[model samples]
Target: MSRASPAERDERLDPVRWHRPTRGTTLRLISVAVLLLTAAAVLWFKPATCTPLLTAPGPTASSTGKAAPQSSTQNQARDQTEGKPAARAIPSGSVGVPIRLADPTALSVVRPGNRVDLLRLESDKDRTTPVANAALVLEVTGADDPVLGGLLLALAPEEAKQAIATTGRGFAIVIRPS
Candidate 1:
């Protein structure tokens, strides 16, 4: 029945200087470290080319069965090589087509010259199908009116036809890299 000396007391009694990690705690720490390292490695290393999840269709023959003209850049390069006075290059393949967006907020995001993919909401479940692939965003009208708040797009003739036909259905725009 006497108090023990400080030096004779067990170190476990000194709560501040002791740490005992449970198995679950150690496993959790290891798992977190592994996850962090894996994330870092994935961020640091990337593939040379990123593959597109869905392929977009380019301008094809128009509804009239006439094939579309080549893009300006290609024509300019050809003209330069052929030694013809670079004819005033014209944008011929795509034409402006108007389509309303189901979501009004979507109108603010699109701008002229931005490449976009058009999708149609197919069912009540929100499933979608790509209607126009890699079409150029020609213009966006900043109107909140449900029917008027939409975008004007420069799409191939076939895509224009598809877009015109798909207007009644729900439309969603997906912006793409130029």
Candidate 2:
């Protein structure tokens, strides 16, 4: 192939021509800018729910300086043992399982004494599978602060074992309609 003349080559190498935007470039740039702004707006205006429920120190009772309401299971345990202290976290035969949800905000609607269904968050598949159903909520902290949120559930010993086995993985709660 023949080389272009030096003058022609110089013109081709001009920075102005090299840096010029093509016809579609403006559209692409505007779209990207709009996307970024939209993302920022969503994050900024969205409810501030960032903290984990467990971040607060101490048991729920200590927070308000009141004795926690005893569940029927706890009462039964106390009765059976004749003045023995029942477990504070959960009823005698049940387990107190702590779980972190995949999306911390999802726990906002949960509350103590509510029955919730636990699901294992299958991140790879973008879907969750059931882990436990009708688990008793022992304590709840809505994720409105600054870290990953948590929930304390009172599950039967057997179901608790299943939930415990999946610890460190993401979990979510479903509040069943009464």
Candidate 3:
């Protein structure tokens, strides 16, 4: 045969025919598959005792050895009976003795007359003193009764002073008229 040019020789040696995979390639693929199967079998068949990653601590006895006793129905009934009020007492007021006028709208009332200053006491520490130049209405019961007057007068000077000072201990029915 006559000698072919370099380009012709290259054309005759087809890349598709030269690059085909062989038996060695098939052996390599099989080896990889076997290795993967062996690893999976070892993981599945291995003897392992699985311990809990997180375990709760066991409960302990309370410091008080005895459990708290529950209240009985009978005990509750007895307590209710003992705490009940016997009766409600009525309230009274008299004139010139700082008779608290019943006025829901007014915060406090000043008794009319010389040295007649009935001040409504406020618990707020900032407003302990009566607000100056503020007008408030007084509500007073006009029913005449000497007993109420005597009762108010009978109170000790200190007690009377205290009663006049604040609204804490006074009868709830008696309120400064607004």
Write the residue-wise lDDT of candidate 3 on 25-58 in tens digits. Answer: 9899999999999999998896664423212223
lDDT of 3 at 26: 84
**RMSD of model 1, in Å?**
18.1
Which regions of candidate 2 are displaced past 4 Å?
Answer: 1-89, 167-169
Q: 40-142 in candidate 2: lDDT tens per residue?
A: 9998896754423222223346457886543355443654488432223455567678887777776777766678999987756777778889887776654
Question: What TM-score fits each model?
Answer: 0.45, 0.46, 0.17
Off by over 4 Å in 1: 1-90, 143-147
| Global CA lDDT computed for model 1 | 0.68
Candidates 1 and 2, the one with greater TM-score: 2
Model 1: per-residue Cα lDDT over 7-124, one tens digit each: 7876445647756999999999999999999999999998975423222234556669987643445544565699542332213676778777767677766666678899987755
The lDDT for every candidate, in the order shown, is: 0.68, 0.69, 0.37
Best-first order by lDDT = 2, 1, 3
On lDDT, the stronger of 2 and 3 is 2
Better-scoring candidate (TM-score), 2 or 3: 2
Q: What is the lDDT of residue 51 in candidate 1?
A: 29
